[model samples]
Target: MLSIEPLNQADIPVTASLHRDNLRLGLFPKLGRHFLGLYQQSFASSPYGIALVARDEGTVVGALFGTTSNAEHYRWVTRNFGSKLALAGCSAMLTRPQVALDFACTRAGRYAKGIARHVGLTPSGSSGPKAASRPVSVLSHIVTDVNARRRGVGRRLIQGFASHATLLGIHRALLVTEEGGLGTPFFERLGCRLVGQHKSQDGATLREYRLIFDEEGAYEDRDGGRVAYTVVRAYPKRLGPASTRPQRP
Candidate 1:
């Protein structure tokens, strides 16, 4: 039987491995498995973070990491694991010089702010975007093992994450994935709407999607647990002209 639940500390290593193996397009994956482990640990440790895993008979088959407040989660990670993560990052960069260049071109400034936030060099309010009165959580990463693909593992993990987010008073969840990537259709199939598109630090075009939860209805998983929201609407806006409009799943 497959089960979706909060990720335990003991499972961090496996979750990190899954991330490294399946989510290779991201910068964190290139930082190596140790860095990925710490990254997952930050989510597992943060109060505002959501870390979950899908297990089949006690073996981890999929994982999801997200944050209710990105600013708070980053602050917590910087305060608690700053030095260690920095050391690991530096070590990785030293061994892989191209990684260093990629970081400089993409994430250097944001990371600098994180460091400044940790040392009180910057005001708390300036860490990132100011928090809204209502919560809007971010779905940062979700991946399933190769053997688990097409078996509903990814869907279960998403439902589990959304259920947890709703319990925290979040009415909507946001995520960004590579344009036309494998994840786009999957998210669209689950009723996420493509809200916008932007270029990443590395100049790759990324698409942002939002999943709005209807508080009145719910979805039940195979295990009979209620997923707090059901996707009921369709994508009404088009990203381009009718000739180029993406098809719905």
Candidate 2:
């Protein structure tokens, strides 16, 4: 039987190793470790972090991690893990210069604008547009052991995260994945709607999927347990095409 629960400190290393081995990003030996360090700081040890792990007979089989507030969580990660990230950045620049350049270029616009806002050149609310005020949560990472696939592990892990967010009074959750990658279809099958699309630093197309919680409708007396939720489908004004929109139960 597969069971989901809060990720323990002892399991973090295994989770990081899975991330590196399963989702290679063309980094060197030590760089991968540093990358995992960033994930660890953001999702495992950070006070604002929320993470879940799936186990089968005491063996770790899958994991998911995210934050309730992107803005606050990012600030905390940068402040606490800044040095480690800097070292990793420097190493990547020296070793994989092109990759580093591409990443920097891709994120430059957003960071530059953010910096400008911080310096009072552009006030936070001065912008004419802003994301919806709904408390948006992020599922930054989700990985399942290869042997554990096709056994509802991924779905249950996601369900566990959703339950956590729901209990915390968050009503929306989102995640970014490569558009044509394996995760896209999986998320779609799990009832997450594609809300946005963009290109990644490596030029790969990325799609954003959102799962909205129906607080009242998600519960009921069903088989002596709560009702399984079916999220509502809604298109964000910023995104195009409703063809790939998610379905409501």
Candidate 3:
């Protein structure tokens, strides 16, 4: 049986490993599995974060990490895991000069600005009056094991995420992916609207997608199936054996 539920502490290692192995487009995976583990931990521990996993029997096959408030979540992560993440990142840069070069070329300035804003060294830009009417959650990361593809794991995980967000009174969610990337069509099929396009610091074309929850209390999939928004609670018992190996999807 396949089940979708909130991520738990024990699932961190598998989730991190899956992230490191499967999601290779960004800089985080190059930082190594330990760094990814702490990254996932930050999400699991943050009040504004949402972490969900899809499990078959007892092994995790897919995972999703998001935040209700990007700004607040960044601050929470910086306050709690900044030092550890910096150390891990430094270690990665030392061992892999290419990763160092990539960071310097791409993320250094953005990260610096984020840190400055987190510590109040930089002023947050004006929110304007319309900011109150816009409550957009972020869908940070989502991935599924290769072996689990075509089995509805990704769809269920997304649906479960939407359901959880709705329970939190969040009706809008946003995500960004590389333009024309493998996941782009998948997201489109799920009814995400293309809101904008921009270039990343690394020069990759990035596409922004927004998903709006309907007032009728259900989200319609591409197949015309209407899935009601309802949270899938975690199982009371711990997971079983951990021998299952994951393949990239």
The whole-model C-alpha lDDT of candidate 1 against the native structure comes to 0.77
Residue pairs whose backbone atoms clash in candidate 1: none
Which of 2 and 3 is the better model by TM-score? 3
lDDT of 2: 0.67
- Among all windows of 10 consecutive residues in model 3, the one with the lowest summed lDDT is 231-240
lDDT of 2 at 53: 89
* Full candidate order by lDDT, most accurate first: 3, 1, 2
Candidate numbers sorted by TM-score from highest down: 3, 1, 2
Clashing pairs in 2: none
TM-score of 1: 0.81
Could you tell which candidate, 1 or 2, scores higher by TM-score? Answer: 1
Tens digits of per-residue lDDT, candidate 3, 1-249, equal 999988998998899889998886678998988899889989889998999999999889999999887878888898888999999999989999998998998789899998988878888764654553445589999999989998889878877777787688776678999887778887776666777999877688999987654333223233334454431112101111112223212
- Candidate 3: clashing pairs of residues: 146-247, 146-248, 146-249
Model 3, position 173, has a per-residue lDDT of 78
Q: After aligning candidate 2 to the native by TM-score, how far in Å is the CA of 34 from where it should be?
A: 3.2
Ten contiguous residues minimizing lDDT sum, candidate 1: 236-245
Q: For candidate 2, which ten residues in a row score worst on lDDT?
A: 234-243
Give the distance in Å from residue 138's predicted Cα in candidate 3 to where it truly belongs. 0.6
Q: Per-residue lDDT for 92 in model 3?
A: 82
